[model samples]
Target: MAPTSETLTAERILEATEEVLRRHGPAKATVVDVARALGVSHGSVYRHFRTKAALREAVTKRWLDRTSEALSGIVAEDRDPEGRLRDWLRTLFEAKRRKAGDDPELFATYTVLTDENGTAVGEHLADLTAQLTRIVRAGAEAGSFETTDPEATARAVFHATGRFHDPCHAREWERPGVEEEFTAVVDLLVRGLRGR
Candidate 1:
């Protein structure tokens, strides 16, 4: 049976594109392959995403958003900002590590896609830093953190913890004592942020 428009949404196309990329890698994957995976025409996939780059970008955004979505709740919770910040960082690290370890092929595909789709990656970084800024701002308001510029502070913290969450450093994630080093870094960051 032909898939109706409702069934052939952009989301479905992106999902199929992801599978195609996972199997064939970015260099070999094509819109037609994504369409073939969905049993649809290439035109059908193009209707949802104007170009292959667009579809790839959308899939990359979706993959990055998974980590952001996982950490979003910690920002919304009414707990101490310090605790929320710690939870958010740990959750993000775990999410990235899981993606890299559990589905390395797809994760590697996304790493390439993310490099190609700089705009999507930028937006994702902005969203993450925004979340961090909120947590920092809350901590400041509660007299637990000292930062005149939460946005800058958040960005600093994000960069400082990059090795723990960045895909480029994924290979080191499983090294012995990596988790201990991660805890040490987080503790130092939190300590530096603490209000006098």
Candidate 2:
């Protein structure tokens, strides 16, 4: 049971759900499990999430938001757009690697949660791509980049760098010399975006 002092808000529920998901994994984690972890009834959880799928989707979005929120700070930095772009991408790679390495169980659980919650995943991607677009557009405005289509260019850069950040490519992130490969890819991407 949660301490009585701690209210069972949506945030608390999401937090407990994440722990539950981590403990039992996506295949077996349930609302009852989350409620049990909270020392509340399943009915209380439903009052906040409405449905079992709703709870899962909310938890998945919360998980993805950790990365998105971190990247958004880089996007908001008032630095050379090219440098900001590089830092942004590197930060993304580091964040993904940390998630996979620091908590292998939770990371594996999120892989399944993400698959089951496409809308959450889609929104996360859109948020990420939008952040990238802001950086690309800023570069174009400063004449640091040549592309007129910042949105398209952002999309390309994102897809091109997917191996660094995509969970599906998690296996490749720790390969020997993968950091060199990531640097090479980033260099090529930055060079491609720069003016002649």
Candidate 3:
């Protein structure tokens, strides 16, 4: 069925772009491929996204937003900040692990897209750090943590746990004892934050 203009929304374009990227990888995927997939004109896709770069960036942002949105819930929970932080970290690690393990080709395509869209990648890092800052600040406020610089602490925690969440380390995620190592690191981080 041909998609009418009424149904040709930006979301649809992005969805089609994702499929194109999955099929073609970032190197070969193009705005034309996206339009072809939708049975629409490339101009129609361009009407929604001003440029090919813009479209790619939007799809990259969309992909990263899924992780941010999932972690946002843990940030909002009114529970022990320590537990919340742990859950938040674990959630992020699991999310990354799943993405890398579940659909590796799509994951690799996104890795390329993310590299090409530095602005979107930077924004994603900022958002993730901001979420971490909130969790750290809450922990400090609740007397569960002893950090005076929550933002810096959050960044440190993020970097320290990079192995579990960073895509570059995706291969190691499936290694034996990886989860145990992640838990050990999280325990050390929480204990360190508690001024132990």
Candidate 4:
């Protein structure tokens, strides 16, 4: 328990909210629970977040931002664009797999939250596709890819690899030969992009 004298911050409230959500899930979690976890009043929590909906939405955005931040590093790396694309896809797949396998309860909680907060989910998808667009544009600019529209190519790439990153397909990620299947698909996409 945190000391009552500790100043309540949005980050602290968010961290507590995540733990509360992880323990109780989105349907059952409450702002009061988060406040209790943080040793603060629910009013203090509300001071940072205007309402329960706002708190949940902010937490969902925070969760999604973590993946975007992770992938942004790969997008910014100065390396062979093709290799960067491959690594980027692999990193995404691995990140999803870890989230599903490592903390399935939290993952399930988030799935529900994502459904409730469609705007946040949509924004997250757009951000991810934007990162992919940068990578594809770099590849095309470097003459490693043949694409008239990098944004379209990025969308295609993202959709093509959805099986690996989409939460709906999480169960299959642990299936036998999933990595081989992912590699084959990535190879085929890379080959297609290379104008082979």
Global local distance difference test of model 2: 0.93
Write down the lDDT of every candidate, Cα atoms only: 0.92, 0.93, 0.94, 0.93
In model 4, what is the error at residue 9, expressed in angstroms? Answer: 1.2
lDDT pick, better of 2 and 3: 3
TM-score per prediction, in order, is 0.97, 0.96, 0.97, 0.96
Instruction: Determine which window of 10 residues in candidate 2 has minimal summed lDDT.
Output: 1-10
How many clashes show up per model? 0, 0, 0, 0
The per-residue C-alpha lDDT of model 4 at residue 156 equals 96
Which run of 10 residues does model 1 get worst, by summed lDDT? 1-10
Q: Model 4, 45-76: lDDT tens per residue? A: 88889999999999999999998889999999
Model 2, 1-196: lDDT tens digits are 6564368899999999999888898899999999999888888888889999999999899999999999999999999999999999999999999999999999999999899899999999999999999999999999999898999999999999999999999999889999999999999999999957
Q: Using lDDT, give the best candidate's number.
A: 3
Worst lDDT run of 10 residues, candidate 3, spans 1-10
Q: After superposition, how far is residue 155 of candidate 2 from its true place, in Å?
A: 0.4
Candidate 3 residue-wise lDDT, 1-196, digit = tens? 5448889999989999999999988998889999999998999999999999999999999999999999999999989999999999999999999999999999999999888888998999999999999999999999999999999999999999999999999999999999899999999999999995
After best superposition, candidate 1 residue 168: deviation in angstroms?
A: 1.1
Instruction: List, residue by residue over 76-142, the lDDT tens digit for candidate 1.
Output: 9998999999999999999999999999888888888888999999999999999999999999999
